[model samples]
Target: MKAVAFVGYKKSGKTTTIEKVARILKEKGYRVVIVKSMHVDFDREGSDTWRFSRVADAVLVHAHDTDALLFRAKDINALFSMVSADIFLLEGFKSIKHVPKVICAREESEVRELNDGLGIAVSGVIASSGIREIEGLPVIDATKEPEKLAEIVEKRGFMLPNIDCGLCGFNCAEMAKLIVRGEKTIKDCVVLSSKPKVTVKIDGQVLPLKDWVQELVEKTIKGMLSAMKGYREGRRIEIIIRD
Candidate 1:
């Protein structure tokens, strides 16, 4: 699924920007999901779900049309795997590098302090102020021109597997920075987008392979598959071994 984050200072118009973007994405027939990173005190102290959390490791509150699952976990990827969508619009999560970010700011300095390399564009109140760009990042008026923002996101937004294995010299977050800066393209990622790439993961950790090694593995797999029934040329193969 495609994913992007919305970040800004308090009351920087992140909510409004996300709402507008979601509307445009929905109009274009894309299923959208919004994930917000918020403070810990979102649940009321005496609420039913909150009260249950004191005694249970996981709490599920089923209401009219919503099922809220509350649990304590440090790994976010586990939680994310449960959600499926065509487009994921995230609010907050300023530090996550797995997805491109749209910065909502009140001033230029806020953009400077908030940007880390994953930023794809600038929006929010700062966009209405006539700032066309900040540090080479385009400023988009998400409130007035959400379609343009949505278009940019559709072309550039990316979601990376959260494993930090360093096959690209730098980690995933570092590669994400290079991507937004135009130094690297999404196809450069060895696992998801690369052509004829060989990726091996042991217990969810990616193993680094040189180019020659990848070619060797790919060729060997192709040759082996050539003799199998119903095997077509250039088809991808995945082998799973469980002991």
Candidate 2:
């Protein structure tokens, strides 16, 4: 499924923009799912529903017709698996990885530095003064033409490739979801080779692994693979090292 997100600071009109976009996409006969992340407590304190969960030890539950419930143990990837939808329009997730994003820009000064690493698909500039276009990116006037914004999302959002190869570990779709949710880190994936490449950081310094360390790491990886075979066969084996 294709995915996109509408992200901005509080009170930046992101919610309104997303609702309008979703309506337009639906009119075009596309199936769309909306995912909203809120830090506020969804369940009331001391309510019957909350009491039942506490008593039953169930972390999450879906009431068939109602929405799904989740406990602290559930993460975004786990949640995505539960819902069925053709396209997911995410709101409030700004840090994960690959989902195209529409950032709400309320000031002209905010336009100078577009954090490319945020993996933004598009940016929506609110009604303001001194707006200028950045090369290779479009700055949108969100208040004037919400439907036109929807068109941009529909055009660029569907162009992404959807191979969930977990080479990115979370898979492509999950990576996009996490990016929109703003909960993903580069260190989470050991297999992503895309560039401008992500650098590994140690302490406060950026450093490359030493040659001896690299060799040791390779040996350790091979050992782990060998150990997996034993687990698959329901047997146990010990690795011994000689000096």
Candidate 3:
């Protein structure tokens, strides 16, 4: 999935800007998912949602027009696994480094915060400052021309599995920052990398492991084989992951 963030201080027009971008992307036939990060409480006592919240690890409330999933977690990768989309418009999460971000600045000082390596554009109040660029990046009008802002995201934004599987020597979040820095690629994700077939079974039941598991097993087997002084790195190997 491709992703970008709309971030700013309170009342900096993040919601409005994201809405506009969502509409524009939808018009172009791209499925979009909006994720907002906040510290507010989302539960109301004595409601059905509250009741379900007490009994399940996750609570799903489905109505005629709305569906909500409630869980005591804030992992964005987990949400990514649950939702499928072409574009993910993130609101808040100012500290996440993997995806490109458009800043919604209401003041000049807020614009300064966009210096992080992940920023691709600026919007909101700063867009009208007659400044064409900040920190060498374009200043866009997310409200007046969301398509243009969307274009910036399409060109620079990115998404990852966010599983933090640690196969590429870094978690998904860390890998994202590396990718933004030109230190990695999608193939660096062991899950997305091509490899020889290796089957694993536990107690006579075949089971599948994620990409990181493959990495761990391959390394462990390679190490063991090398200890005998006859095995080499490119030799064929097979191993099983079991409890």
**For each candidate, C-alpha RMSD in Å?**
5.2, 10.6, 7.3
List pairs with backbone clashes in candidate 2.
Answer: 93-180, 93-181, 95-182, 96-178, 96-179, 97-179, 101-121, 166-169
Worst 10 residues of 2 by lDDT: 196-205
Which of the predicted structures, 1 or 3, would earn the higher TM-score when compared with the native? 1
Off by over 4 Å in 2: 55-73, 109-116, 119-136, 158-243
Highest lDDT, which number? 1
Number of colliding residue pairs in each model: 0, 8, 0
Encode model 1's per-residue lDDT on 1-243: one tens digit a residue: 678899998989999999999999999999888888878786789987788899997887788988788886546555565567888888998888777899999999999998987888999988999889997899999878999999988888887766665656667888888888889876767666654477786645456667889889888988888988999976768988776
Q: Report the poorest 10 consecutive residues by lDDT, candidate 1.
A: 73-82
Model 2: per-residue lDDT, tens digit, 1-243?
566767767766677777877888898888888889888877667977777777674545567687666554344544554566667888877653466777665554443333434434345545434343543345655556657777877765621323354555466657655654458643444433342222333322223444455567655755677656444433433344444
TM-score of each: 0.75, 0.55, 0.72
Could you arrange the candidates by TM-score from highest to lowest?
Answer: 1, 3, 2
Which scores better on lDDT, 2 or 3?
Answer: 3
Please give the CA lDDT of all the candidate structures: 0.83, 0.58, 0.75
Residues 95-211 of candidate 3 have per-residue lDDT tens digits of 876676788887767878654666678887777667778766778777678899877776667876565657578877777767666687767876546453555654432334665
RMSD of 3: 7.3
Off by over 4 Å in 3: 45-47, 62-65, 163-175, 181-188, 193-243
